[model samples]
Target: MTYEIALNKAWDKIAALASSKKYTVKYFTDIYEVRISDRMMLSISSDTPASEDIAILVLHYLTGFLKYGYNPKEEWISFKDIKGGQSYYPAYQENTIKPILEKFKEKTDDLISYLTESLEGRIVKGGDVTVELPTFSDVYIRMVLWHGDDEFAPEVTILFDRELTEIIPSEDIAVLLFNLAKRISDEL
Candidate 1:
């Protein structure tokens, strides 16, 4: 189905579930805020409005949570742990990681700064620059970016909690990665 159709369906589901599910919806200035979790929040531009891509992401995220309910196991796992994730590993690396590595290269510090400032990403220890990205109410996607000098090529890793597979689909995960990378690139 087209994204528009999907968005409409998600809207219907959200509306239907909102009252019964007790979703927290609030208005902040021009933006409409939907607090999915303490850490994960979604907002829509009330005036000119954000792009449809972001709206769709929020819509899909809400719909997924409403359908599956939030019960994160609090444990991190690579995409390989997800269903059919092994087959999509190459795409995940190419679509999400390669571009970050290429764009950041020796400028890993800049990437960290952009992530923290623009995306509210929190730094972690593991890679040269690791950030925990809160994507949904119960979904936290961690991005580990290993900075490299002239001798080594920069590497990137995107990790998700094991419980994510129970809600979001593998294909949607790819789309999420693409959009997320695009968002980071836009800030760069």
Candidate 2:
């Protein structure tokens, strides 16, 4: 579907729920402020508009969360682990993973600093440099990077909370990661 159509459909779904109280209680406003990263915030309300891509992401999260409720297991799993994530992995790698790997391969320290300080991520144990970042309230994405050796090229893996599929579909997850990779790459 076109982004505009998808956005309107998402808004319609949220409107059908009748009240924004649930959202306000969780996010502090009916406008539904969403953090794309620590430095980026998008408001998901008619009065406070956003770009179609961002609006759809915010609204999709709101609608899906309303329907499924937030219940993160705190278990981190790779994108391939999500339902249908395997089929989507090739495109995901090209769109999300490859860009990140290319950008950060040589600037590992810069990447780590950006992830930790700018994005409010915390360094974790894994790969050469790993960080777990909160993409939304209580929802985290883990990025693991392995600098290349002579035998292999550098690699990057993005992971999400295991229960995320219960809230948003794999398609939305892919968009989220794509946006994230773009955002981070753009910043540094």
Candidate 3:
């Protein structure tokens, strides 16, 4: 379906459940707000409209959250490990991983600084530079980067909470990562 159709459908689903006791008690409001990145916020309400791509992603997340509830297992896994993630890996690599590698390959320290200072990410072990960036309340994305040598090319790896697919489908996950990489690589 087109993004507009999908967004409207998703919004309708969320609106249908807005008055439920479970929604009010757990969420505390019919209007829901989600952080798309440090620079953007997606509000799920009739009066607040967002770009179609962003609206679809936020609505899908809200729908999933209200239906399944949040229960992150804290275990991190690669994109390929997510259900149907393999099918989207090529695009994810090109759109999400390649840009980040190109942007930070020669400036690893700057990348580290940006993550910690601007994105509020925390340094973690594993790669030359690894950071756990919180994208939402209790939801995070782990980014691991290895600077290139004469013989090897720079590489970046992104990991998500094991339970992330419970809240975001595989396709939207690609979009989410692409948006994140764009934000990170964009001139700041």
Q: Top model by lDDT, which number?
A: 2
RMSD of each: 5.3, 5.4, 5.9
lDDT of 1 by residue, 1-188 (tens): 24667656656666666644234332212233543222223445433343455555665666667678768787878877778888988887787777777767756678888777766678887787789876664467788877667898678888877777776677777777777787667667
* Candidate 2 structure lDDT: 0.74
Q: What is candidate 2's lDDT per residue for 1-188, written digit by digit as tens?
A: 45767766776766776344334312212245543222123455554645677667676777777788889887889898988988988999998998888778767788888888877889889988889887766677889888879999888988888888887778889988998888778877
**Where is the poorest 10-residue window by lDDT in model 1?**
21-30
Candidate 3: stretches off by over 4 Å: 20-49
Error in Å for residue 186 of model 1:
1.9
lDDT (C-alpha, whole model) for all candidates: 0.66, 0.74, 0.72
If both were scored by TM-score, which would come out higher, candidate 1 or candidate 3? 3
Task: Judge candidate 2 at residue 94 and give its lDDT.
Answer: 93
lDDT of 1 at 181: 81
- TM-score of each model, paired residue for residue: 0.75, 0.82, 0.80
- Candidate ranking under TM-score, highest first, comes to 2, 3, 1
Candidates sorted by lDDT, best first: 2, 3, 1
Off by over 4 Å in 2: 21-48
